[model samples]
Target: MNRLTFELRLVLRSRLSAAALLLLLLLSVLAVWSGMREVQRQRQTIERLAPLHERDVAALAARYPDSKDAGNPAYYTFYNTWDPPSGAAFLALGLRDVAPYVLRIRALGLQAQLYEGETFNPEVALPGRFDYAFVLIYLAPLFTIALLHDLVSAERQSGRLRLLLAMPDAGRLWRRRVGLRYALLFACLAVPACVGAALSASGIAATIVVLAVTAACLAFWTGLSLLVATRQWRSVTNATVLMGAWAMLTLVLPALANVALIRAIPVNQGVDLMLAQRQAVHGAWEIPRAETMRRFVAGHPEWKHQADVPGRFHWKWYFAFHQVGDESVAGAARAYRDGLVARQAWTGRLGWLLPGVGAQAVLHRLAGTDLPAQLAYQDAIVAFHREIRHFYYSYLFNDRPFGSADFARRPAFVPHAAAGMPGGTELFALFLLAGAVFAAGVWRLGRLRMHGGE
Candidate 1:
């Protein structure tokens, strides 16, 4: 017990170790605050839109006080749909930083509106937000390297390493030293995160899962540092080699994997679907009215009996053409969505080999801030759009007069429930990888022996 206490005091007394821990704690706090602020902003935006959307609808209702057509209301009134952040979202903003959390869609071709208002540079989103996950995955390892890189090299340089190694309890001493540093680093990162999780009301299970991931990440770094630091090399050389390894794991490999996934998956179908849907909608103007209605009836056989349009222009016929346009590119839309899912799957698979990527995937999945989460939100929007079209179709197909009261009856958007806990596959993989590396490092340290120069 005294030995452990002495080692802890020694680590804290080192200015470098103390400063690194302090900086990491400060960064973690800032990241948590930034993430919470962003989440609040998104919620406020969603809430603000409700009243504004109501105001627009109310004004439109006043314009159509005497009008009986449901087409105008369906065409002009846009319903608000939003995906609220999960309680754990502040830990890792994930794809939410780039994807639209709120959207407004009318009863028009959905493919176009689904991807609209969602513009971001692929490069800009690659680095990710300054959330707790970023701090944990990217910054923590550097600090670990700073503290552990000179563990033995500094003693060797000062001509005490040989004497220390000859000590009867040298192994215990090294273990105590390394263990103390690891605990300190873990505390610096975990304390702020736990506080933030409590404030955000991130469920107990989620908080525990995140903390477990944090431990695995730190273990991996500590292990890697030990593996390198045990070698017979100068402190400067150890620092340089560890920094290079850091770049390889955190930056180079992930970027290369991203490129490979992009080339392999090829999700250009998003733009293709949008253009195809728009072209189909525009081409409807040149096609015969009967032809458009005929195509629409084929898909919606329930409305076949009332498909007749005697006039040159009817609300039913106009809506039928739009519906037909959406159907025209349904194949392309499916392909686009499938491609995105494939990409996300491949990224998850890569997490097995990359600790940084694994930590990120786990955090984002828990926070409901991954590509899969975005895809799920889009699926919800599609379902809601179907409801919207059917509600208006009731009035159009039956020729029922739409009134101000009927506007209130229009379908309201119900967001899907916040994302539930994700699978533990990635977490387990991270544990295995970090555990293996850390074990290897420990083994190497135990095998350390003095050479002539030592």
Candidate 2:
């Protein structure tokens, strides 16, 4: 205990250690604050849009009263669907900035409405958000290497390592030193997180998970640093090697994999589907009405009895051909979806080797902010788009009136839950990286011999 206390004091006295610890704490706090602000901004947008959406719907019904025809209502009316930020969304802010959380769909061709992009600055998104994920995955390890890389080697260089090892309770001495540094680093990270959670009013489970993951990450990094320090290498060499590894794992590998994944699976069929759907919907105007109704009734036998084609403009035929438009590109839609699924699967596979990528995948997956979740949103929109078509088809085919009252009673959209936190893949990857670093450090420390006191 006494020897460990001495080591802690020695570390505390170093100007570099103090500065590094302080900087980590500050950066963490900044990340937390930035993340919370982003979540709040999203919430505000959703809240503001509610009334505007209501007004838009009311205006559509007011302009095109029932008995007028379902065609006009279906043509001009827009349905608003939004995915609100989850309680824990502030922690990761995954994919939210790049994807549209608020979408305006219509009773027209569904494919056209589904792939619309959000209004975000691409330059801002290029660097990615400096949220909790960034701090934990990118910066925390650097601090760990900084504080622990010289754990034994610096003492040896200063001629105090021999004296320390010669102490009666060397294991006890080492434990105390490790504990002090670990606790100090953990506190620097945890304090900011606690404050952020409190500010966000995050759920108890979410806060606990965040803290647990943070601690686990710190423990892993500390173990690696301690192992490397055991090698008794020069502090400069240790720092260089560790930082290079961090860069490769966090930045290089993920970017390379992303490029390869995109090239391997080109999913931009989203645009092609939209264009085809537009042509099919608009081309229905030139087609014989009987042919469009034949296709619509074949797929939808329920509406066959009510099918009727009116002169000039007909809602039944208009909406029927829009359905035909969506169907026209079904093959491309499936291919696009398959491509996305492939990318997601490969990313999950990549997580096995890279802890940073692994952690990112887990966080976004848990947060329901991943690509799969985005695709799921599209699926929901497709279903709702179907319901919309059904609603219009009833009024058009059966010659029923789409009154303002009916408009208020239309089927509304229900959002799915956010995908939740890190899984075993991340835990396993973290273990592997830490284990390798520890082995190297141990070998270096074992080869080392020490002299006297500072």
Candidate 3:
């Protein structure tokens, strides 16, 4: 106990060690604060929109006080759909930084509405926000390298290597030093995260998973640093080598993997689908109305009996063409979504080989803020859009009067359930990679020795 206490004090007494730990702690706190603020802002925005939307709906109802046709109201009326952040969202923010959380859609061509207002850039999501995941996955390892890179070299430079190695039970001494550093690093990260989790009501199980991942990541870096630190090299050389490895593992390789995944998957169908739907809708104006109605009725056979259009212009005919436009690009839209899911699956597979990527995958997934979460939100929107079409269709098909009373019966949007925990395969891959690296590091530490010349 006395020796362990002395080692702890010794580690903290070093200027570099003290500064690194302090900086990590501060960054962790800042990250948590920033994430919480962002999430709160999103919630406030969602809440703020409700009254504004209600006002818009009320005005629309006033405009069409006793209208019989549902066409103009359905076309003009916009419904808002939102995906609220999960309890653990503040920990990772994930795609929420770049993607839309709240969107407004009407009973129009569903595909265009889905992709509208999206200014998506793949690069934006690359350099992530300064959230806890960022601090833990990228910066924390650098700090680990700083503290452990010179663990052995500094003692040798100070001419204590020979004496220290000669001491009885020296292995225990080395273990104590490494273990203390690891614990300090872990605490610096986990303390702020736990507090943030509690504040967010992120749930006990989620907090444990996050802390576990934190420990695993720190252990991995500590082990890797130990491997390099145990070598008969100068402190400068050890730091250089570890920094290079960090760059490759965290930055270069992951970026390359992303490029490869994109090329392999080729998800260029998003733009194609959008354009196709627009063309289909526009082309309907030139084509015979009978052709459009036929296409719509073929898909919606339930409305076949009311498909006849006696007049030159009817709301039923107008809506039917729009529905037909959405159906025109349904296959392409499905392909586009499938492509995105495939890319996400490939990313998960890549996580198995890259600890930085693996840790990120686990954190964002657990927080329900990844690509899959975005896709799930879109799916919910799609479902709601279908409900919207059918609701208006009933009024149009039966030729029933749609008035202020009918406006009250419009379907409200329900946000999808929060993304579930990370898959077993993902968690297993992360732990397996971290554990292997940590074990190798411990094994190398065990074999560490000082030559007589040194």
Candidate 4:
């Protein structure tokens, strides 16, 4: 314990070590605060939209008061659907930055409304947000390199390597030093994260999982740093090599993998489905009204017995064809969603190799802001859209009048429950990689000799 305390003082007294630790702590706190602010902004936006949405609905109701036909009401009324942030969302603002959290849909072909783009600046979003996940995955490793790259090189340069290695318990001494630094680094990250989780009321289980992942990541980088530092090289050379590896792991490889994954799993079917649905909906206008109704009733036998269009337009016919348009490209929609899921699955597999990606996968999954979460929101929208179609169908097929009073009866959109945290497989892969690298590092350290050789 005395020796450990001495080593702690030695590390703290080093200007570089003290500065690196302070910088990491500051960055971690700033990241957590930034993430919290963004989450609060989203909540405020959702809250603000509620009143505005209500006013819009009221104005539409007032405009079409006592309408005899349900078509006008169904065509004009825009219902709002929102996916609120999960409790852990402040830790990692994943796809939420680019994707729309709130969407407006009507009783129309859902595919058209589902892919509507948000109005965020692409330039601003290009580099991604500096959330807690960003800090942990990208910046933490650099801090690790800065602290550990000179662990042995500095001693060798100062002619103390021979004396240090000659000590009776040299291995134990190295362990104490490395372990203290590791603990401090882990604390720097975990403290801010725990505080954020507590404030957000995030689940305890999820927070523990995030902390575990953070520890594993730190372990990997610390191990790698030790492995490099133990090599017979200058400290500057060691730092350069470690920084290059960091860039490849965190930035370059992930970007390449993303490009490769997109190529492997074609998701252009989303755009194709959108265009196809538009054509189907527009093409209906050129076809005879009887032909359109025939096609609509063929799929929907429930309305097959309904009377044909009495005049130029009918609510039932209009809505039925929109349903038909959605159904026409159902296969493409499924393929597009399947492609997205495939990409996510492949990325999870990639985590087994890249600790940085692994951390991202686990954190975003816990936060319910990954691609899977976005897709789950879409699924909820589809379910709610079905409910809407049914509600309007009851009025349209049965020829019941729609009025201002009926506007209040419109079905409200409820987002799906938050997705469960990342599974054990991903967590296990992360720990396994960390443990393997750390063991390798320990083994290399054991082989270090007083002769300034590995």
**What Cα-based lDDT does every candidate model obtain?**
0.88, 0.76, 0.89, 0.89
Residue-level lDDT tens digits of model 3 in 47-148:
999999999999999999887788889999999999999889999998899888999999988887777646577686667689999999899999999999
RMSD of each: 1.6, 3.1, 1.6, 1.5
| Worst 10 contiguous positions by lDDT, candidate 4 | 113-122
Candidate 2: lDDT of 427? 56
Provide the lDDT at 335 for model 2.
86
Q: Best candidate per TM-score, number?
A: 3
Model 2: weakest 10-residue lDDT segment is 445-454
Instruction: Superpose all Cα atoms of candidate 3 onto the true structure and report the RMSD in Å to 1 decimal.
Output: 1.6
TM-score of each model, paired residue for residue:
0.97, 0.89, 0.97, 0.97
What does candidate 1 score on TM?
0.97
